[model samples]
Target: MKTVTNISDLRQQVKDWRQQGLKIAFVPTMGNLHAGHISLVEEAHKHADKIVASIFVNPMQFGENEDIDSYPRTMDNDKRQLIEAGTDLLFTPTPEIIYPKGLAKQSYVEVPNVSDGYCGESRPGHFRGVATVVCKLFNLVQPDVACFGLKDYQQVQVIQTMVDDLSMPIDIVPVPTVREASGLALSSRNGYLSAEEKAIAPALQQNLQWLAQEIQYSRKTSPDHSPDFIGLAKKAAAAIDATGMKTDYIHVSHAHTLQPASEDDKELVILAAAQCGKARLIDNLQLSLA
Candidate 1:
């Protein structure tokens, strides 16, 4: 319920909580919160004694020509939602506070290999911004556990890789993607969709689900061809295109490394990003053939 914009104030409050032997959970997000984001805070409660949610529309994570300026900022509504979701503290810092030395001079973090494909390929330098800001938040909050939504599947893997490689002491927990009755993955960006576009948007998830089922069914039947993954991806892309949305990338990859998957790979995930109307949407589903 309490909101502090300064880093020192945020840390001091956390320090007091630490003295009380309270385990902290952190959820970092941009301002425009929805059920998807609140779900993260709700999930955080099961793992820690207190939850600290941050709202900073990270400029570092956005690319040139991206919606940096127009990205929605609903702080009043976001605070209300976070408080209602049982978040203990809200850290809402300005860009200057986060990057005191200025963005150009600030140190950055990058997780190679895991961040190299999928969204990484579509938006260059995106993961570097994500890893850097997340690292900053981790250092500032020093929580015992952090919760991230699995809607950004590759992002989850990237952060997991960063934490394991850097030996950061925070446990990374991934909450499942929250969706609508219509099967659309709930996202802050969903706000950008027009009514007409909204109706068609759920097709993205539908296509991904259809592909997952096809892959699973094919493997179960012991098909000779092993289900052509590449062909399925292309067909999925074409399906999205038919819906009048532009497909960014639809890829099937090894769930852990985000690399192209082979039939022998037991764990796989299908991830896709597409633009519909003004909203840029992403969704994924994980499968285990093992």
Candidate 2:
């Protein structure tokens, strides 16, 4: 597998592949590769002839007090895993290459309302950074299809909205979230957890599952009733807090619009974020009542 750090080099590689009549699939990620990331590459292979993965930790996505400094790099190890996963090309660019004018001077893209709650509420301007960098990557790779994990559920919705609104031609494919046996979603930030914190982490996933069950049961038992979702969210937050983790937010929203789920909404998604030890983790589950 070839790794290119410059846009020109990446373009040439992609051009050559296109000339050969091969379609490209792209997976954009920050380094510190894990099984979940590899699964994204694996899913990419199913959609196109070649897969190109990029590893650049976007600084714009980090909040003022967030741990951008401590975010894991793990480039050497990441390369090994990507090559093992059968990645065709890897793009590893510096920040200057990605944003030559610096973030302050660089133009950004935002999807507005879709990015305003859940993780967006907790980390202001975070999705703007994500939308901008993803737009840049989409332009750079010019892939036939791009793959993203459902692990970042809201992120998937935001990007989907961006593509639809901007009329981007590439297909956005979502792979299921890869999880540990204990149910914690696989994340690069998972490396930050201590042993004790790791044990407490799975509760995030369990509680989300519990919430899903409650929502499903409510739909069945009280067909005409609208369960007080806000009150249920508080109870869910308390359940998570009881696990010794600090809750960020736990709310139910429409699966597609990310607005508060209503009585008539057949598709709903429950999303959560919390701080466990030094790591701030997020997870969500989508459900369709009808």
Off by over 4 Å in 2: none
lDDT by residue for model 1 (146-206), tens? 9999999999999999999999999999999999999999998898899999999998999
RMSD of each predicted structure: 1.1, 0.8
**TM-scores, all models, native as reference:** 0.97, 0.98
Candidate 1, TM-score vs. the true structure?
0.97
Would you give me the overall lDDT of model 2? 0.93
* Maximum-lDDT candidate: 2
CA-lDDT, candidates in order: 0.92, 0.93
**Alpha carbon RMSD to native, model 1:** 1.1
